[model samples]
Structure formats: structure tokens, C-alpha cells
Target: MEFQELINSPGLWLASSVMVIAVVIQAFVFLRAALAEARKVGMSRERYIGGLRSAVITAIGPSFSPVIVLLSLIAVIGAPTAWMRLNDIGAARTELAMVSLSSALVHGEVGTASFGVEAFTYALWGMALNNMGWILVSLFCVHRMSKIVERLYAKYNPAWIRLLMSGTIIGLFAYLLSGQITSPMLHGQYGKLCAGFVSAVTMLIITRLLAKYQRMQELALGLAMLAGMLTAQATFG
Candidate 1:
């Protein structure tokens, strides 16, 4: 069968949906268990609810970029593959890179007339194999990581530990931002720099102006990201 004919086949959709459903079920189960534990620990209901609200709010901004990437993937791959991968361990950038590499290895390229069933199949396998290492490491090392953190807490001041963690997060973000801001390929593109600067300023403004508003505090990240996106569109789109 032609690759195009198979891209959105019912069989593929069924297989992918099953995995996505399993992930969603697991998430709900974990959430329920967390809420139960929170109640058992004498945590205040309002505080627990507020934490949940904050999590949802903060997740919105980070999720938007991934969703945009997923939409693009749907056009290149298919609905089933894109949905399943993004729903599972697939990161948009990583998945795209893997797919392109797989295609190249097979002497083809995605969206080109030469790319066919064989290339697509190889890309799927590449995505699956590449992600397995990270998944396995996480499964094996998560508990060990928790133990290390516990030991750190026992040995050091909690405030200092928190500062260290915050610094680590800031450093990681700075590293990512620096690549985009300084890349030779992006030297003439002001969109990325403009977006980053707008987002940072918006976040600072929201943090300072909405300091006393708990509900607004939860929404600060999303609002900042929206401001960044709008600025990028106005400047470059």
C-alpha cells in the first residue's frame, strides 16, 4: 500500500489511542493518590486545591509550544504517530530530529516524493529506540535521585538547598536561551530574542504587580508566554 494511504489508517489510530489512553489513566490514578495522601497528612483542603490550581496554570504556558510542534508533526507524520508520540515520551524537537535522521539514514527525507513506507517505518523505529534509554534510566534512577535529595536535605540547610535548586533551574534555562539567542543561524532573526525579552519582562511585571493576588500569581507564567507569542507575531510574522 502507498505510504500516504497507510499514514492515517484505522489500525494505526486504534493502536496509538490505546497507548495514549493508558497514559491518561495513569495520570489520573497518580493524581487521585496524591490528593488522598495530602488529605491523610492533615494538609488543608484549600492549600491542596491551590497547589493543584497553580500546577494547571503553570503547565499551560509550557504546553503551548509543544502543542504547536505536535500540529506540525501531524502534517509530516500522521495523526496517529504524532498523537501517540507526543502523548508518550516524545519531545517535539527530539522527535523531529530523530525522524529527520532516520529518513536521512534511509536515503530519503520526510515530505519529499522519495519518502515512502520504508522510510516512515524506519523513522518510527528510530523514535521508539532513541527514547527507550531515557525511559529506562528514569525508571531505574528516580528512587536513587530521591534518596540523594533526602541525604542532601539531612546534611544541609533547607534554605541553601532551595537556593541551589533555583540556581540550577536558572542555569539550565539560561543555557537553552543562550543557544537560541546566539546561534549563527539565528543571527539575523530578531524574533527569538524579542520573544525572550518580552516574556521575561512580562513575567517580572506580573510577579511584582500581582504579588498580593493569589489567583493572578498562578496565571503569571501563561500571561507572560502569551505576551511573548504576541510580540513575536507582531515583529516577525
Candidate 2:
């Protein structure tokens, strides 16, 4: 059998759906728990539901960030494997790299050379092993990390600690944005920089100028991403 046929078989799709189904189930369970807690804390249903709507909208924009690389993954690894790996924790690029590395182990090249069933099987094992490592570490370390955070909060001023934690998240996003915006500049291109700039401006406008519109505020991130992507496409494409 050809590699593509095996990778994208109906059985593979059914198998890959396991992760997607698990994610859906977890989402529903968490949503129910959150609603229960909201009732216990005397939060009105309207307010909590609004927050949920906003969170979902906010998530939609960042989810699109993976689409370009996701297409490449689908092309090289076939849709079912790509679907499963993407639904897992590993980044799309990292998963693609693992496939390449694993295929190399069996002397097969992806999308070019004779990467048959054997190489594909090895690639599956490689991604599974790589993801297992992350799962194991999270299993062992999450509680410890939570405890450390709790102790730090107890030891330090709560306000300052909150700010520090906020700063850490901000720093992480700043690094990610800088990489996207500046990398292309090194190659004399400004598409990513333009997109990032447009997105930031859109966010500021939504938050500051349109503060009275609660719905818009909730959708600020998604709107900003759309505006940025459109702007970049018009300017660069």
C-alpha cells in the first residue's frame, strides 16, 4: 500500500479523533465546573456567559496562527496524522521536524523520496515518544510548580507577586511578537512587522477609543488579528 493511502485511511481518522474527542469532552466538563463555581460565588449567569463568549472569541484568533504551518503538515504527513499531532500539545513545526528526523532514521525523505509505510510508522513512534515526554513531565511537575507558586505568593507581597506573574506572561508574548516582527526584517521584508504593528494599533483603538462597547472589547484580539492579516495581505501579497 502507498504511504498516503495508509496515513489517510478511514481507520487513521477514527484513531486521530480520539484526541479531538477528549479535548471536546474536557472543554464541556470544565465549562460545567466553571458554571457551578460561578453560581457558588454568586456570579450572575449573564456575566459568566459573557465571559465565556469573550474567551471563545479571543481563542479563535490565535488558533488561526497555526493554519499556514498546519497545511504544510497535512501535505507532508497526511491529514489524519497532522490532525492528531496538532490536537496534541506539540507545535506544528516541531511535529514536522520530528517526522523528518524519524524518516531520516529509515533513509526516507518526506514528499520526495520513497517514504513508505515503514518510514511513516517510525515517524508516528517518534512523535508519540516526543509527546509522551512532555506528558510525563507535566504529570510530575505541575503540582510542584503550583506549590512553588503558592509559596512564593505567601512569601511576597501579593500585589507585587501578581504583577511579577503578569510581567512574565507579557515578556513571553513580547518575545514571540519580536521574533515574528523582526525575523523578516533581517531578510529585508516587513510583512510580519506590518501585521504586528497593525494588530497592536487595532487593539489600542478597541481598548481605548471604543471602551464603551463591551462586545467590541471582548472581540478585540480577534478583530485585531483579522485587521492585521488583511493589512499584510493587501500590502505584501
Candidate 3:
């Protein structure tokens, strides 16, 4: 569709608005959390901002996490087209149907699909805002963890363990998305179970690996556990 035509489309506008609203809500929650953490830590504004940078990296986990399912659905939708000379066989997967459905339910795909440019634009920016919000929260978590380590430096001989745990948690989350073990979005309790299992397993495996690498990383692992619990809730709860 032409840009003008796309602009005129009601669907597009609706989609964009939904996207904007989702991200804005995420940002508000994140900022509130950040403010609370800042007060708890008694951190200067500069340090808070600096911590935000690190948090951004951590926040990345959730921002793109949902995309794993979204892209899978897109691939699924595009698969038939390719068979009709639209999709490449290299990309086809059974996971698409499940992930798409899950995402549809969570994101209100019906409402979004009805929208066009507006939804798309909002989704784009909402993703950005959401990630930023996530980063802020992650920063607070990381900073708090860092302080814990500093205070108990003598007992925490394996500081590297924390970073490893965090990295592993992030990596495992990536793996579940990559493996597409089961379609989480399909209709039924089984679909939710499958999604929850995959998320839980990923969290456990990553935490275990990090723990083995460093004893001091136990604190971070605890955080990972919290993340895992939250992830499970978000995906299937």
C-alpha cells in the first residue's frame, strides 16, 4: 500500500496506538521500580543512570524474548506463501503455529491485526520503550547484587560467578526460543504447559551452570531464579 493509503487505513492507526500504549505502560512500571531501587540504594543520579546502562543489557532478555515467538509465527504464516513460491524451505518449523497462537493471545493479536500502520509504529516504539524500562529494572537489580558482593568480599571469593550466572540465564532463555521445543501458543492447557516447562527448564539449566562456575554467584543465581519464576508467570500464568 502507498504511504498515504497506509496512513489513511484505520487498521494501521489502531495497531500503532496499541503498540505505543503497551510500551508506555512498561516504561511507567520500570521507572517506578527504578526510583524505588535508587532510594533503597541511596545512589546518586549519575550512578543510577550508569547502572541503567547495565540494566539495559539485562532488560534485553524480555524485550526480545517475546519476539522469539512472534518471529516464529511470522515464519509459520509466511511458510505457505513460500510454498506457493513465497517461503524458503530453510525456515519452516512446527513451532510456528504454537508460538504464534501464544503471542496472539498475549499481545491481543486480533486487535493488533485489525490495525495497520498505527499498530506497527506503536509496536516498534513500544518495543524500544519496553526495553528501556526493562533495562532500568535490571540495572537496579544488578547494582543491588554488586553491593552485596562488595560487602562480603571476603566470603565471596568467586565474583565472576555472578556475571556467568547472568549470562547463562540470558543464554538459556535464548535457547528455548531457538529450540522451539513445543508450540506454546496453541489452544489448550497442553500448550501452556509446554511453554511453562520450556521456560522453567531453561532457567534451571542456566542457573545450574552458573553455580558450578562460581560459588559466589549464588546470589545472582537467586536473582535468576526470580527471573525464571517471573518468566514462567508471564508466559503461561
Candidate 4:
């Protein structure tokens, strides 16, 4: 059968559905464990429920972008592969990049006639293999990470450790943002810059204004993202 035919087969659909069901079960298990721990730690049930509701609300806004990307992937690949990859890794951009690289290696590109069965198969293998390293490393390192943290705390003041953590987070975000802001490809596209700036400003304003409101503070990030998207559309679209 052709790659497209194979990807959309009933067998593939069943496999993908099983994987998704497993993820759902894992999520429920973790949630149940966390709630039990929270109760043991004397957290109020109402407060715990409120936090979960706020998290759901916040997640809904950011999830739309990934859903849009998933739709695009479904057109390029097929429903089964798209659903499995998206659900398993939850990183559309990384998955798309790996698929593109695989296609290029096979002398084809996605969404074109040259992307045949061989290219599709190559892309599938690439996606599956590329993410394995991170998973393996995390599986091994997660337990050891606590030891590393303890060493750091023992060697440094608690305040210094906090500062280091905050600085690392800020530096990482700045690095990512700088690439977009300074990219030669985006030199002429001021809309993206404007949107980023607007988003940052919106976040700061919301944080300051909603400092006393716990629920509103939780929504700040989502609202800022929405504002940025709207500003970009108005300016560029």
C-alpha cells in the first residue's frame, strides 16, 4: 500500500487511539496522586479545585496554536500519524522540523509530489528517533537532578541560588527572543516585533494590575498572548 494509504488505515487509527488513551490514563493517575498529596499537605479542596480550573482556563488559550499546527500536519501526513506525534511529544514545531529534514535527506519536500512513500517513511523514522535522546537523558537524569540541586544549595547561599535560577530563566528567554528580534529574515517584518513588544507590555500591565487577584493573575499570560496575536493580525493581516 502507498504511504498515505498505510497512514490512514484502520490499523493505524487503532494504534494511535491506544496511544492517546494511554496518555489520558497517565494524566489522570498523576492528577489523582497530586490531589492526594495536596490533601495530605493540608491544602483545602476548594483551593485545589480552583487552581485546577485556572490551569485549564490558561491552557485553553495556548492550545489553539498547536491545534492549528496539527491541522496543517494532518494535511501533509495523515490523521493517524499527526494525532500520534502531536499527542506523544506535544511539540509541533520540533516534529515538523525533523520531518522536513528527513524529507530533504530523501531528496523530497513535504506537500509536494516528490514526497512519496520512501520520503514519508524516512520522515516517520526521523521523527521517532530524534526525540529518543531527550527522553533517555531525562529518564536517567531526573533523579540525579535533586542531588545536583542539593550540591548547589550547599555551596551557595539560598538567595544566590534563587537569583541564579531567575537569571537562567531570563537569559534563556532573552536568547530565544533575541533570535526572532534580530533575524535577517524578519528585518522587514515589523509586525512580529510589534506584536512581541505589545505582548510584553500587556503582560507587565496585567501582572501589576491583577497582583491582588489570584484568578486574574493566573490568566495574565493567556491574555497577553491573545493581545499579541490580535495586534499581529491587525498589523500584518
Per-structure clash totals for the candidates: 0, 0, 15, 0
Q: What lDDT does each candidate get?
A: 0.87, 0.90, 0.50, 0.85
Can you write out model 1's per-residue Cα lDDT over 29-94, one digit (the tens) per residue? 999999999999999998899889988988877776688888888888898999899878867889
User: TM-scores for all candidates?
Assistant: 0.85, 0.92, 0.28, 0.85
Q: Please list the Cα RMSD from the true structure of every candidate, rounded to 1 decimal place.
A: 2.6, 1.7, 15.4, 2.6
Question: Which residue pairs overlap in candidate 2's backbone?
Answer: none
Candidate 4 Cα misplacement greater than 4 A, ranges:
103-108, 184-186
User: Which is the better candidate, 1 or 3, if ranked by TM-score?
Assistant: 1
Worst-scoring 10-residue span by lDDT in model 2: 108-117
The whole-model C-alpha lDDT of candidate 4 against the native structure comes to: 0.85
Candidate 4 lDDT over residue span 1-237, tens digit each: 976788788998997788689789999999999999999999999899988987887888866779889998998878998998898863898889988999899897988988888888888888879867777888999989988988999999989998998999999999988877778345677766777888999999888966888778778878888898799889886
- Model 1 spans with C-alpha error above 4 angstroms: 156-159, 184-189, 235-237
- Candidate 3 lDDT over residue span 1-237, tens digit each: 753355445665564455456656888899999788897988887666655654665565544444454454433322222122111111223233323344444453423454344433443343344446656887789889888767656465566666766788989987865555345444353544554455466657666765564332333433553555566667667
Which prediction has the highest TM-score against the true structure?
Answer: 2
Local distance difference test, candidate 3: 0.50
At residue 8, candidate 4 shows an lDDT of 86
lDDT of 2 by residue, 1-237 (tens): 677788899999998899889978988999899899999999988888889899999898788879999898888888998988988889988998899899899987988757878888899999999998998999999999999999999999999999999999999999998978787899999988988899999999999999999898889989999999899999996
Candidate no. 2 TM-score:
0.92
Which pairs of residues have clashing backbones in candidate 1? none
